[model samples]
Target chain A: MGVASTALPRGQTVPLALRWRRLGRRLGFLCGLAVLLSPALFVFLWMLSLSLKPDVENTAFPPVFIPTSPTLDNFREVFATSPFALYGRNSFVVATAATLLSLLVGVPAGYGIAKAKAHGLAFVVLVSRMTPGLSYLIPWFMLFRALGLHNTLWALIITHLVIGLPITIWVMMGFFEDLHPELEEAALVDGGGIWAAFRDVALPLARPGMVVAAILAFIFSWNNFVFAVVLAGPDTRTLPVAVFNVLTFEQLAWGKLAAAALVVTLPVLLLTVLVQRQIVAGMTTGGMKG
Target chain B: MGMTLTSAARHPGRPARRAVASYRRRDKYIRFALPALLVVAAVIVFPWLYTLYMSVQEWQVGSDRVFVGLDNYANLLRDARFHAAVGRTLVYTVLAVTLPVVLGTVAAVFFHRDFPWRGFFRGIFVLPMMATPVAIALVWTMMFHPQLGVLNYLLSLVGLPPSLWVYAPDTVIPALVLVETWQWTPLVMLIVLGGLAAMPTEPLESAVVDGASPWRVLRDITLPLTLPFIMVAVVLRAIDALKAFDTIFAITQGGPGTASETINIYLYLQAFSFFRIGHASAVVVVFFLLIVALAVGLLLVRQRTKWA
Candidate 1:
């Protein structure tokens, strides 16, 4: 209807054929979106159905798209037998630690890289990020083990840093580079020290960007599958690892598995919803550089 | 933030303390930047160097190592399984990249236009991208169950035949691709949506005003301008697809008889499962080179197109 309406702006004078064309165009556009989004949407709904269905219903042929007599057994099972609460606590601690550590170290580095125009350092950081996690797996595992850090939250926290720090640097790099230097210069002219100037002028302006970076980093650390699987201890399994343990220990219990999976995804999903705009910005801006 | 940057030297009183002040400032920059650099070095540098060293030695878990030169590389090249995996990896990456790019662009375009419940739909659209990948894998694993899965149930309603998806060797990569496409297409859409939002409106308006069909206006004006952003998406997806492991690991573990084993799976199997540490180091180095090469090539293309 967009171009069609442009061609025939006046509704009263528009020909019937033109009106039909506009309707057809609008229908076609809506259909494209429908076809594109249906699979993603359907899978989610199907997961919901799976989670709510009975164990017998979960395996029935012509699988129930919507549960007729949904039960809370799966949800009950998810919390009843497993150490889900412990896993959730562990994930929170590790993800928060990673985010705070990344911000502590990466923000200053980002500002330095921006001001110094340190392309080489930036390249080094980006390449570190680009390298597959597998490449770092064995060595980090052995090194931490050698240092008596294996199976400790410390080890997981350190490994998670590899994922979170680069993200902070990446998002903050964009923010710092775009920040006007004049603000910092004005503070310096007022006889402030460099740190004072940064704290007063630059840091406040970059707060929004820092929040975006932190949220992105937090989500990534929370969702990271490999690092936790390899580094975390028997007592310190993250949610992904704990959920995986459910899949294996509980066997194919699809209903319970669905419930477990949903539990694992809920926190991250809520965070994403809260900061959808920032997540999109962080991803696109960080993605563009790589 | 190791060795990030130095602070500026403070003005010395009567110019007598200039040297010490400047030195301290330089030291401060070194100090501020050092922590990040140290972490990178400890995490990436030390491990990578160890991997390179391990690649040349016949090392195993809890065993003495001996120098083996490039024999592991040579042996891997001669292995048919490795070659097949390389081929499969390329094929998977191609499908994974192409589908998301095209479908995502279309979805992006559709969302760009004024529509009913656009915000609500967009919120739904981005959910897939934000959900944990491990969770997505588990959910898809359930849905991919042949007789009991909801996907086939839906297909049965539409009169389409149900087929073995990840359970069959031949269809395993395709099934894996389906999961990947579902998970990643939203990301591509978000990127393209960002691009579309940023695009100038004048060219599109003028094209429609000049009596061009809507299709022509899209093809000639909209698509070309968004090509750069699309290319960026391509580059990101390509790298991601090349290294994809979690879903494959969780669902199939490169199974249905090695049908879906990408480089990552193979490396994991060699290193941790089989304990062929030396051989796995060789695989690591080779994979690292592949990533670097693709990244450089894509960056060059991006630069040539002025997408920077």
Candidate 2:
């Protein structure tokens, strides 16, 4: 009876105050989160709103946060005016070819370097990545023209290797280092050659790393501007160049511009959202570990 | 034992042959790495060397090539525009890198705490880093409009006067840096967050148990431990900001009276617009050296502060 009487008042008074404090803290956290995220969210939302709204609403004073009557006319106008489909196809081809080639070559190189501990070779490859795109562009432009490869997808594919190959090598190197050598050694002990060991054991193990490398390479190639701007002709221009052309040729049609911008970014955005964990893992490990 | 004894009696040279075979196998890594190295040599190494060759010769469109040894470098040394571009690049890099590292560290610490839907919020935060730069530039160009843009409207709401975002000569670099900060701060945050996640919890808990304040623990423990990661972010950001082109080219094209022209923009104009190939090659070499030097400097600092 004494214990029950003691517990009753304590629970009644203390629990109420404690719950109120917890509720207040929760509210404070939500507010801080909103404030932190608003800027990043605002830029994207504003672009989305501009793309959906008509021209009149887009340029209105006290800018509209939400579109009153969103329409697809702006998107229609963009597709009608530009060869955006062709540009998209060109980008896809270049990015895909570059990524595949980087994997075919860079994966083995990464494995070799990791196994052999060829730090000098790895550093050389990194320097290639760090070198400015423009440094390679002028010479590549002349060489391609001389070889009649300029204004073709071939040129873009070859040039994009500068971006894709290093990333592939670095990421694959990190992955391969993490893998124990015992499995490959066991395969070798069974009279399998080095190539067989790699193919049978390490390659299968490094598949996820290859995926990460391929995605990063493709995204980078897709986003490339300097090489395309210098080398690409009217027929070979990629999506980024197409977007830039929209601004130069068209007047300040905010809706159309926003529409064009969203179109180019959509694929990468989708990839990022879908594989965010992989991408983050790749970025941190690829960047920091090396 | 009987079969092994008979085989050994029949082939005494087998051991010698195996030694030779194993020796050959030791160089197998070279075979695997050859294709990538050859490709890199053809595409990157050779091209850079060719650029070095071109830097010594004056070549322009519709004109005969002339070898002008050291003339281009000499011109670069005295060129006021080149000097200005270099200065602008350094300033922009500093502004961009410092702001992101600082703001990203804060954001990283904030996100380190447990909150509802933290993963969802983090995904939203990283969207900017993934978006295409040209598209981002276009969107920001519209938003930076002096008269009808929402930014000014938001500013007015806070009882502050509207200012030119990317239009004015003096405001253009800072304005561009703002966008760089917005897009890249998340990268720094992610890197630092990884560092935080990997850090041990024992020290922090003991400090808390010892009645140390949260602020003190953060300053004394968290920041010091995360410094290496922060340095990594700084180096990456600096390198990128020094090479930034797509957004600035799209937004201003180095306009407002050449106030925003960085080294990349200037080099582009020199090589393409003016067709001064040799001069532009010289600029490329200088820009490359600057990057290498900055990287080395930052790496040294990182080495000094590196933790296990």
Q: Looking at candidate 2, what is the lDDT of residue B235?
A: 84
lDDT of 1 by residue, B182-232 (tens): 889988988888788888989987776676877887798888888888988
State the C-alpha lDDT per candidate.
0.82, 0.86
TM-score winner: 2
In model 1, the runs with Cα more than 4 Å from the true position are: A1-29, B1-31, B114-117, B301-308
DockQ for candidate 2, please give it.
0.41
Residue-wise C-alpha lDDT for candidate 2, range B1-308, written one tens digit per residue:
23333544454444566566546665786677899999999999888898899899888867888999999999999999999999999999999999999988998898887766777788777888888899989899888889988888889999999989999999999999999999899889889988898888889777766766667888999989888888888888888899999899988998787899999999999989998888899899989999999999989877875643
- In terms of lDDT, which candidate is strongest? 2
TM-score of chain B of 2: 0.89
Q: For every model shown, what is its TM-score relative to the native structure?
A: 0.91, 0.92
Backbone atom clashes (below 3 Å) for every candidate: 12, 0
